[model samples]
Target: MAERRVSAGRRRHRAEWLRWGSLAAAVAVVVVFLLSQGQDIDVSYGQSPASSDAVAEGGAGELGDVTVPSVDEMAALVRADDVVRLPGAIASWDERRVREAVGDAEVRILVAPPGLDEDERDRVRDVDDATVRVIGTEVTGGIYQASADSAVGWRAQFAVGDVTDQMVALIAQLRDRPAPEAVDQFDWRDPDEAELAAVAADLRATGVHVGAGATLDGIPEDLAASAFPDRRAWYVVLPRQPFGEPVPRYGPALAELFPDTPVVVVYGWWIEYHGPHAGDFDEVVGASFYAQLGERLSLYDYPQRNVLAGYLARVTDVRYAGLFDRPLPYRPFDPLRVALPALPWLFTACVAVYLVLSARPLLRRSGAGARTGVNARLAGLTALAIEVSGLTDVSGNPSLTRAIGKLGAAGEALARNLPDRHVRSLLDDAEAELDDTARSLGRADYRPDSYLSERLA
Candidate 1:
């Protein structure tokens, strides 16, 4: 009992601590999260080995293990490389990190995200390649310019060989003015330079091959001429793979354009955040991604906290916990089930309530008048009355008293005159109860409440 009490005390303490600790931890995490939120730092995650039914540890926050890297052959392309590619919407590269990742790379390629108005992404498809890599899925075009500090003169990456001073000046100028004139949507504007040779020579020594993707015809010949070194400069495009072959294979135009160049297929409409209801948030997330990352965008549920953050905590914590113990076991859950395995306490509470309510009335009324055996007192009273009235007792004898209750047969006729059934039931009940009393054979006390004493005395 003491051990159980100690255990109970410990349980209560632990529960209290958890409650308080959780509250404190929650506030701390929130404050810390908010504090760290606007910085360049961002978080990441994946699934757990502990749970089979569990897709991710962060519970509802995780969208399952996915990113551009988790997708098919594209995973190889997402790997760290001198090359940074963009083949989706203007919103796709909106994330500040991704924006920087692409904008600052030795080479960058971009495609328009799907659902673009024909004019919006017209520059992307004009390229001769089989694919057009989408740019920013979650970023707006306005914010993409602001955050990248690459004010509207759009230029893809260029490989350097004999870096002229003019080319160096052009690189810097392109870095400053990324999207040209905001004038011709398909102009594909880039700065022309031949100013710095040393940097270009240094770039070539790295033995890095860099090519970018575009809508082949989209880059106005003027812009392509300015952004790249020569007409020999190349770009990529994407076409739908032939269906029904065992493995989907790239078709002719895809192969013909850049046979020696790295091939990156751009999928604009691929699902991002898929768990249960994936499509619901994708539009807003993919469209506003760039500005949101730059903190220039606001008012949406797809923010890191609402979307990726919860997932980060859920999966990371669960994954981290595995270092100490096997993770919580998993089984499928049915919400509608009346008997859920998680609700054992509810069942126990119901049963305990039933027993308590039932037993209380029994315990409370145990010694009410009937239990005191008033009928035995009435019998003694009747004997006195009979002694006074010259009437016979229960045995049908003209006697004042009789030992033993064979007299009950005689008493039955007299008992019919009584009005209260409760009193009468006492007579029936008393005889059985008499056997149960502790004073069953003890001498009676003649207190007024003690009805059996009067008759015997």
Candidate 2:
């Protein structure tokens, strides 16, 4: 009879475990389904247009009167792997142009100058007319990379700054070329002839092919052509002030004349600065600006040169290497992306509650101090959560630390109700561990590596 009773108890335990497992699986499926909904609402990966379709379908027509780089010119640049600088206001057109220009070349699109209203972003996304693989436009400055199955990752790469330099450096590394040298010292106070001579001499000395010309109106093509003849890429220096009249004509003229050459326009009030290094330009920025611009040039019909003016400072200031280290994949209207912060906490809370409720009967089977066990179990779970949040270093780290203190209070209350000495002893040990962990967290000296080490080994 005793043997039969033991067998029956074993069957009951297995049945209970099976029931709990099924519930857990169901909860997991629900959470996953909710998260996956983000990908479904995004641009369909299956709908990515072919390069021929992009070129034939044409995105230039949508750009109104904007000046577009010639497809042949773009192809040559792509073939030579040269970087072209353009404007960000024409990003929609640029994206399309890049798609058409590279044919089947591996490319990455990173949308930036974040904090645009949702409607504005949606409009921009719709007009760009290509499936974006990553969205690097999060307010927290993270990259949402696309996973192997093309699903967006839940966590973003935590980083901030202008990614232009990193992108430039990355391109240089990829192409096996040295970092582009900067020409920050230019003699802007000299006479027109003297200034032109100095610019030409600087270009020759550094082997840079970029030209510093007032405009294409009277500047000799020989001067511009001679600047960087063999490289097939050209740069022009533009004036920053009195931009209302001269600027419009200046842009179109370059596009019209050099229909085959990739152009980068460096804008500043060059003549105002009389010092020796007065007309200097940040080489990294120039290289990065052109590289990014080149990559996105295919989207607009006409390039607006200074749209990234406000962003220049921030972009150049980014010291973090992780910002553009990976590609950010984003979907339009992803509810999950917007609600990232609250989701993890909500899921943890719901699961913890469910487990406590589901295990109520088992606690009662002990026939004494069942309620105390339930409370103790809850305190233990809460302490674990606090420890995890402290270790992970999320935005909610402070709140999680405070929660540890609260858990300690609750654990003490629950332990006082326990009648058994051994049970109380175990509860005391657990509470002591929580106290130590909480103190470490409070000191802000707790490293995740050490916390992980304790758990793992």
RMSD after Cα superposition, model 2:
23.3
In model 1, how large is the Cα lDDT of residue 411? Answer: 35
- Computed on alpha carbons, the lDDT of every model, listed in order, comes to 0.30, 0.35
Question: What lDDT score goes with residue 441 in model 2?
Answer: 53
Best by TM-score: 2
Clashes of 2: 23
State the lDDT of candidate 1 residue by residue for 363-399, as single tens digits. 3443556433344444454333222222221222212
Instruction: Report the poorest 10 consecutive residues by lDDT, candidate 2.
Output: 149-158
Residue-level lDDT for 412 in candidate 2? 42
Each model's TM-score?
0.18, 0.23
- Find the number of clashing residue pairs for candidate 1: 74
Q: Write the per-residue lDDT of candidate 2 for residues 236-306, one digit (tens) a residue.
A: 44433231122222223444444544344444311111111111233333334333332222222222222
Show model 1 residue runs off by greater than 4 Å.
1-184, 188-367, 370-457
True-structure lDDT of candidate 1:
0.30
